[model samples]
Target: MDRKHVLITGGVGGIGVELVRLFAQAAYRVSFTYRPGEESRQRAQALLDEVGEEGMHALELDVGDRQSHARLMDTLSLPLDIVIHNAGVGTKTVERAAATYKEQDEVFFRVNTLGPLWLSEDVIPGMLARGHGKILLMSSVDGGITHFPRFRAADGMSKAAVAFLGRQLAATYACTGIDVFTVCPGATDTPMFQASTLDALSAEQRRLLEASLPGGRLIAPREIADLCFYLCRDEARILRGAVIDASLGLGVCPAVMG
Candidate 1:
C-alpha cells in the first residue's frame, strides 16, 4: 500500500510535535502548519531535520484567518488522507471574563471551532472524490465536563461545538469511506497544560491535583499520539465516529463527563 498523507495544524506545539513525529515514523507523508514567524518556521524546519524524513513539510497558517486557510487549501499539491485539527487557543484572561469574554469568545470560535469547520469544508470534497479520508478533532475534557473551576468558558464552548461537528460529519459520511473521530484529552503533560493556571497552584494544591487523577499523574502527550496513530490504521475501522476520552480516568466520573 502507498504511504498515506497527513496534514496537521499547530504542529509546533507540545502534543502536535509528538503527533507529527509519530506520523512521520509510521511512514506517512506529513505536512503541518504553524503561525507566521521566523521562529515558527525555524522550529518547524529543525523538527523536520531532526526527524530526517523527506516527506515532512511545513507551512505558515493562522487558523483564525479565513483568507490564510483559503490560501493554504489552494496551495496544497496533494490529496490528504488524514487531516488533524489540532490548533486551538483558550482565553487567558481567566479572572477578568467580564471585560474580556466577548473578544476572547470570538477568537476562541474562530480558531478552535469555525476554522476547523471551514477547513473541513475545503478538504471533504477531495475526500469524497477519493472515497477515503479521516478527520481527527482535538477537543478537551472541559468540553464534555469535569470538576474544574468555571473558567475558560469560551474554550469549553468552542470545543463542545467541535465534538458535535465530528459526530455530525461521521454520521453524514458513514458509508462514503470517510471517518471522524474526536479525542477529548484531560490534563496531558503538554506545554500548554503546564502553562495553564495550574502553574500558580501551591505545592499542596499541585499534589492534590496530581493525586486526584486515578493514576496520580498527568497523561503524556506521546500516549495520546500513539492512540491517534493507532486509530488511523486499517484495523481500527470500528472506531469510526468515536468520541474517545484520552483523559487518564477523568471520564470515569459519568456525572461530570457530560
Candidate 2:
C-alpha cells in the first residue's frame, strides 16, 4: 500500500485512542495494539468503528511479554513507518518493604522500559532497509524532569530508562533515516490518571489539585496526540532525540506535582 503504516501500543487507552484516531484521520494505515480481553476487544472495535477507516487493525498485545513482541512483528502485514511506544503501567504506591514490591517493580520495567526496547529492535532492521522511520516513546514527567512525592519509585525509574532509550536510539540512528523522540506528559486527564491519582481524593481535594495546576486542569490526551503526530513527520527530524516535556509547566513547578 502507498499509505504509511504506523503501529501504536496501548491503543485502547486514553492517549493511545487519540493517537490512533489522529493518525487514521491523517491517512496512515494504523495497526494498534490492545491488551487481550473481551472488554479491551470491545473498546478497540469501538475505536475502529469511530475512526471509520478501512485499514486500521487492532491486534492483541501483552506489552510486558518479550515473546509477545516477536509475535506482534510476525503478525504485521506491512513494514512500519512509525512506531509509538505508548503502553505503560501507571504509578502504584507501594512501600519498599512490601513483599510484592519486587514483583511489581519488575512488571513496571518489563512493560514501560523493556517493551519499547524489544519492539524497536524488532522493527528497526526493516526501517533501516527502507531508509526512513519515526519512533516516539511516551514517557512521563516523572521520568527524570520532576519527582512526585509518594508516587511509585519503579514507575519513575522505568520511564527514565525510556527517555534514555529514545536518546540512545536516536544517537545510534542519526543520519541513517531513523528518528526517535521521547515525550513526557504531566498529569494527563486520562482514565489511568484518574484511577491512579484522583480517584482517592475527596471532592475538595480534587478541586484543589486541579486548581494548583498551571491552567487549573490536567493535560488533554488530544494535545499529546497532536504533538506526537507532528513529531513523527519528516520535518521533525531536526528534533530527532529531543526529550520533550509536554507537562504544561508541571515539570517546571514541582511544588504542585504531588
Candidate 1 per-residue C-alpha lDDT over 122-212 given as tens digits, one digit per residue, 9 for 90 to 100:
9999999998999999988877534354547677888889889989899999989898999988878776676674677888987887887
lDDT of 2: 0.88
- Please give the range of 10 consecutive residues that has the lowest summed lDDT in model 1: 90-99
Task: Give TM per candidate.
Answer: 0.91, 0.95
What TM-score does structure 2 among the candidates reach?
Answer: 0.95
Off by over 4 Å in 2: 93-99
Residue 235 displacement (Å), model 2 = 2.1
Cα lDDT for residue 201, candidate 2: 95
Task: Estimate every model's Cα lDDT from 0 to 1.
Answer: 0.82, 0.88
Model 1 segments beyond 4 Å from truth?
Answer: 93-99, 145-147, 202-204, 254-258
Error of 2 at 87 (Å): 0.4
Best by TM-score: 2
User: Model 2 misses residue 144 by how many Å?
Assistant: 3.6
